[model samples]
Target: MKILPFVALTATLFSSGAAFATEQTVTLNVANATCELCGPIVKGSLSKVSGVLDVQISEADGAAIAKVRFEDSRTNVPALITATTNAGYPSRIVQ
Candidate 1:
């Protein structure tokens, strides 16, 4: 029927839009993370954020770096930074 074709077209269009969604990775420099336990805290904070796929924490140059991978459609860099900051680890994007 004509309606069936219309429904199929609509489904295809919506599904195709989802295909454009991208996963982004960014490293955040957490200035307040100064101890060994800080890594887990930072990772936990980032993991709690919606759309965060993965979080890796490492120390470099006396600062903690949190590497985060997330779905761009659901979260952005600012949200990630806010999450860490709210958890007492204020951070900025590593250039």
Candidate 2:
């Protein structure tokens, strides 16, 4: 049997495969963030974490949505959550 060409295989793989490293929207549920007071602290904390691109914390919902551009190699969700928690508000990965 003849083998499939390398270029064709490569194209198929790219079309079908899930992206490993890409900008992803992850929502964070935060505890104890209930006022404008909590906003800047959450923003600063998340900013310190490596590989974070965009962060938006809402005191109304007590949540933070981050547009994170990170390599699983450079950083991860757990680490980011820990950073938020350490800053003050307890946070968990919601998405």
TM-score per prediction, in order, is 0.84, 0.63
Number of the top candidate by lDDT? 1
Q: Spell out the clash pairs found in candidate 2.
A: none
The TM-score between candidate 1 and the true structure equals: 0.84
Residue 53 Cα positional deviation in candidate 2, in Å, after optimal superposition: 0.6
Write one digit per residue (lDDT tens) for candidate 1, span 1-95: 87999999889978766666799999899988888998998899999999899999889876799889999988899999999999998999889
Stretches of candidate 1 off by over 4 Å are 2-17
Which 10-residue span in candidate 1 carries the lowest summed lDDT? 13-22
Q: What lDDT score goes with residue 64 in model 2?
A: 46
Candidate 1 C-alpha error for residue 12, in Å: 7.9
What tens-digit string does per-residue lDDT give for candidate 2 at 1-95?
Answer: 24568777778777754345555556777787777667788878877877677777665465544444454545678887897789877877664
Runs in model 2 deviating more than 4 A are 1-20, 61-71
